[model samples]
Target: MKTKKVVVGALAAMLSLSVCSLAPAVAAGETVQISVGKVNAKAGETFSVDVSLADIPSTGIQCLDFAVTYDSKVLTIDKVEAGALVKNGADSKDASASLAPLFEGSVNSSEGWVSAAWSTSTDDASYWLKSDGVFCTITGKVASGVADGTVSDLKIVPINRETYSKSGVTNKEISCGYEKDGKPVKYATTLNNGSVTVGTIVTTTTQPPTNKIVRGDANCDGGVDMSDVVLIMQSLANPNKYGLDGSDSKHITAQGQANGDVDSDVKGITSNDALKIQKWLLKSISEL
Candidate 1:
């Protein structure tokens, strides 16, 4: 019995040691660490940032609240990008500019990126250096707010210190990473992960006026009626205004990747409407 007990104790200790070694060392305190990946970049050009928790607590963080910090003398914030618009009753109106801090003001909102409730000290997570110790910080909240399909394209933008500017155009490539069960699990990059190059971003939105006008009203005489059928055939055949293969170019979006071929919905303004008109016209001719 004594021999068996000794063996069991030894096994338990070995297992514990193995587990400890497998865990990455998390330090104690609040800090912002950054990496530029293993590459060199030109001034006023784009670069990538590899983010992680730093000055970490050794209590073995179930979650770690962190923010990134970097020198802004070498870099500057450019612009803000967005995918969706918030409702009027929602939190904030869509603003296209970057953060503007007061003498001692800070801006880092957690809701802007990732599936997080992270709140920045200032309004948004943007920074430019007046004279810097740490100007740019990609604050991250270490909760599972991103696990339930809540946030999309959660990432950081870090332009090269040598190449960032405010007025002139510059682009930054941001990457994201995460830890699972207190260990490194997964992350993102520009390959399968997305990247936004901060060049010239132009948003073309045509607002609806008091009157909406479209020439071939796909319903009336020139609209969506029988004549529209003949118009569609003409469109398919002639397709070109002056001289072009207008029929060959169409933009269709089905969840994604437009499957528009020569006979399919190239741009969702489908030719099928023309087909419907053809059928209706044939029936009318027969009835007459």
Candidate 2:
């Protein structure tokens, strides 16, 4: 970890001018993507999202600067930390490379936005990030008054000069890529945003009837079987057709969602729930 002032100074110097036009087009057949992870939490609960990178170029990446925005009314950013990709520093193609990356960020809870910059601490190319993994983590707290079922988007956007003026500005676009012979080369990139959904909180005073829930019986046909797995997958892949409020008569209901949430590692009815059901049916696992 680098000092915030030092990191901000380096970022400011690097982004003082726009470099968007100087970047070359992405190579054919090469793909680069940045994504934000999603999760479910209750109002006033603390949560975190992972910012990940995929399909790093053969040359590897040296520096990255990006911003994430959220609905301030529903969430407040707490902290930003370096992730595995920066700390572990393993190159996919080079077994010997061990990078020492530095990370720093600034958060504005009132604006519901946070900006971060990460890079190799030295000019050595060996220190660059060369693998696909999490780049950073953003921790936040959901507003206490938010209602259940409310969803807040965690959107990735360009680092705006005006917003991150203290950190300086290179361009309004997301800056990523490595230096080629001392010159920065940007990558052609794609982005996938994520969200945090407020879930129903079970309290002693009043809660959904747990006794009525038939765990793993997602289809509500009175049995835990492969059909329940199918329903869970369908609901996730085609929510409008098989979701809780789906128009299709075979849509999974609220009870189905509760029943399908057998996997403790994840919240809500995800594909993991479907996999758990399959495992139980195969006798690989005694129960869901």
Candidate 3:
């Protein structure tokens, strides 16, 4: 009887432990995402790509080192500047004793690379990098003699261990993350690469009466007509079909895209812009 009682007690204890193990443990969520915006340029023209981040964890970023590579043959690196997020101190607080941020980056045309690193002197819990916003801007010029419709990649360099690396590619190791309770926390992130394209001049059947292109001429054919309206509608309705993605050389030219602003607002091209263009063509309004 004594032995049976001891066995029952042990079984009960094991059952309790098993039930506890079934409960899920909570983990800190951290994400670093790199996004690129509107990568198109004409030959001999200076253009820029916006790099942004989202879902930044509160552990904040202790240190970050990354690099971007472009084709030197077609493009030349000009310079890199701190984005609004960093300049506004979006990541760190203004409290006294908070670590000051240090930013460093450069454009190396010779190496076809733009490398940047950022960090804070204090790794205390009081500091946190901004959660979301433009991280930096990469400005460059399309090199002369590059053929129209040429496309090139904007790849992230494997500068450190924490930096996202291509599969099967080896690179130097570096650590970056925020501190929690005096302990270092690793960050997980998703990286989105980008590409730049030198656009080709598109010729259309209908030309504007004047030599100058008019506003709302989304096709760059020198005129804003029903065709332009159709084009804009198609682009908005199904961007994939028209190669509206900047990665494709045949994508809508930057000028054409800009001219789509019939609303005369810098907000960006939207369905409303298309509607406004239609209204203008119908003589509903004198100006866009």
TM-score to native of every candidate shown: 0.18, 0.60, 0.54
* Better TM-score candidate (1, 2): 2
- Highest lDDT: which candidate? 2
Per-model C-alpha RMSD: 23.1, 8.4, 16.0
After superposition, which runs of candidate 2 have C-alpha atoms over 4 Å from their true positions?
1-29, 89-101, 162-170, 200-288
Cα deviation of 137, candidate 2, in Å: 1.5
Number of clashing residue pairs, candidate 3: 5
State the lDDT of candidate 2 residue by residue for 186-207, as single tens digits: 6766887878888753322122
> Which regions of candidate 1 deviate over 4 angstroms?
1-78, 85-174, 191-288
Give the winner by lDDT: 1 or 2: 2
Per-residue lDDT of candidate 3, residues 1-288 (tens digit): 011122212222222212223421222465566655445567888776666666666545655556778889999878877765556453454332243335556677776878765555454544445556566777788888787889888887544221122223233322345444533454555666777778743433232234454688887877788777766544533343332553334445556666775653323344456678888889998887
lDDT agreement of model 2 with the native: 0.68
Give lDDT per model, in order: 0.25, 0.68, 0.56
Worst 10 residues of 1 by lDDT: 81-90
To one decimal, what is the Cα RMSD in angstroms of model 3 from the true structure? Answer: 16.0
